[model samples]
Target: MRCAARRCAGRRRRRRARGGRWRRPRRRARAEEGRGLVRGSSTPVRGAVLLYGLLAVGAVTWVLADRGTIDLWRHPEPLWRFPFAAGLAGGLVVGVVFGRIVAWLSRWAVRRTRWGAGLHEEFHALLGPLPDSDILLLAFLSAAAEECFFRGALQPTVGLVAASLMFGGMHLPVNKRFIVWTIEATVLGFALGALFWAGGQLAAPVAAHFTINYENLHFVRRYRPA
Candidate 1:
């Protein structure tokens, strides 16, 4: 009877020890999951705040700059009558074509070269896991604010070349992708500037910008690696 009691006590002790070992790992895993959830939730908030902040700043700057020079409500018709409907249709077509070409080139480059793949991955990381809705909003707001400031305000004052250069330069940051991004931005700036110049109104460039951004955002979100 004494021997049986002693064995039973030993078994109980061993079981408790085994249970404790399993419980510790389970607790650690739960803590890690909680941390991941917090990070995932916070990232979108930060991205939205940054995008909206840019929109607000751009809007204020445009308002201040164009106070008397360019009336948002009125513009003298160009000698060549580029109707608003025609401009909108043209902008949409051009924007879609341009966006498709850019996306195809980017994807091709990513598949072809290690450097391109690395850049693609880096950009994906930078964008994070933004939802489709947030991405759409960001693209639209960015297009509107940037077009208002660059095409609506700055281009008229500084001329197309200067405005486009400034637009390109604005993208330069102390990063590995700065030069590439700057060049791409410069080219895009020129295209948008030309559209603005041709249409003689903010509508064309704004539509084009929005279209390009929206398409690109969707492409990146859909094709980015898991």
Candidate 2:
């Protein structure tokens, strides 16, 4: 009788999931979008287009304005050393450590502050509908494109402070409680700038940024449903 009861419950749960319980969170996120609490259209296709468009712009800007040179670094190298292999390895390590730090801080915020919890929910709502594959793609693209544009092309043109400020402004808050994201991004931009300056190439900042995004976005995808 107990075994039969367990089977019945499992069947009922599957039925409920099929009945849309599994998609409730996504629907709720869409509803929030309707209400204007969420920003931007969050579809995977749109996201890809936007990222690629930025990448093209970066490439063009890099060719024209910067004259294809990177004198902004503390020790600028010949463009022949494009990969910067050592910096990539070191930046990967730094990215992992920084990701853990940010994760710890985010958890603390969610647990300790009411606003933090709400902001967390807000991100979920905005990002809930993405498939796991899309999360990975977006993570890589966003990191690569952002680092290319901000650290690679723009920094050499405008200098660190100006470039970092623009990067921060690009991630401005969605709401009052979400100001923390903007501040965090700004600090991260500067850190990435330092990495660029030290490593003397775009590879380090791109690798580090990619690691951080992969960590955080995968975490978001794996978050327990509320």
Candidate 3:
């Protein structure tokens, strides 16, 4: 009887150990699931905020432009000098090419450096798992609003270099990667500013901005880890 009782106790211990092993994984899965839910729920709110903020900026820009508060075209080229169609086409090409080059460089840096990799991951985390349609709309709105304000209104007043620097500075959130992001934004601003200066209209910079944003977002959505 004593031997039988000892054997039963050993079996019970073994069963508990086995149960614990299974329960740990289940608990971890539940925790991960909960986190995912939280992230998913917050993405729309972020998107909405971004959309509205861009819209407000665009509205202000439009009002200023209408009121002659800002000169979008300082040089005031003849209509024949920078034809809308030609400007749009050239801007599209430049944007696509520049965007691809930047994307390639980013991929290379991510692979080669820990800092690059971390920044890449951080960006993905901030974006979360937004739907493709929402991302597309966000991209469009961002391009339109930003170009209207930055290239259209601010660039003419501040000059290209100052405007580009200001654009970069605007991106410098109080974060670990503030410098890196600011530098990146500065470089992009230079490109867009050049487009605006060359084309002497909002169409060029807007087209370029839209193309770059659309491509970059799509790339992130498609290539980022599940």
Candidate 4:
């Protein structure tokens, strides 16, 4: 959010991460109150909630309807299995790695093309108003719901390529943006799909997805182009 500057500076000076609830500097808090900038609802947050809720519900319904095909956890291997634990651990590693790569890509894109710069601007414009908590919550919600629908429900039915393509397509921006966004998302879909297919479970993909979302959101929020 645009408040990244204030938030970052405040964080530098503040003592904590709102042990119970989020807080800001006394002066900044009063300033925001005066400007009527603090509120409980906004267009971006509401729209994301509705969209992600639908994706989650649809994924659940589809999975339930076609459980014969969609495998949530590895078969024959119990939840306590070592391989399953390893898969989740591996996914988390992959997620952190990918998140960093994408953040680098963001910087490169901004320097290379107008489309990239536009995408970066739009990214900030859309997310700039949100606080850290909402960003994390939405990132988790979107990643889980998306992985459920794409990797969990669809991959089994349509195979990996198709599911990955659909996943990338789902993220196309309404306005112009760098094509690399879709390209990267498609690649990510492929990676996630492969993760699901190999593990024969949802745990790895979900873990990886959440980590990537969390890491990337924080990176982009703070990142500034020179």
TM-score winner among the candidates? 4
Query: How many angstroms is residue 176 displaced in model 2 relative to the true structure, after the best TM-score fit?
Result: 2.3
Q: Write down the lDDT of every candidate, Cα atoms only.
A: 0.66, 0.68, 0.67, 0.69
Off by over 4 Å in 1: 1-80, 224-226
Model 4, 126-206: lDDT tens per residue?
Answer: 767456666667777877888888877777767789999999998885665646678878988998787677665676677
Models ranked on lDDT: 4, 2, 3, 1
Candidate 1 lDDT tens digits, 84-137: 787667666766666566657767766776656666676666675556555666
RMSD, each candidate, Å? 6.8, 8.3, 7.7, 11.6
TM-score against truth, every candidate: 0.67, 0.68, 0.67, 0.71
Candidate 3 per-residue lDDT, tens place, 48-106, comes to 55664775566466647655554443225423355667766766776667666666776
Model 2 over residues 1-226: C-alpha lDDT tens digits? 9999999999998998888876898998766544311134366437665766777576556746657553332224432343557656666776667656666676677667776677777777677745555656666777777877777777766788998999999888877866877887899899888777766766567666776666666666566434
Candidate 4 has its poorest 10 consecutive residues by lDDT at 32-41
Off by over 4 Å in 2: 1-45, 69-83, 224-226
Between prediction 2 and prediction 3, the one with superior lDDT is 2
What number of clashing residue pairs does each candidate have, in the order they appear?
0, 0, 0, 1
Q: For model 2, where is the 10-residue window of minimal lDDT?
A: 70-79
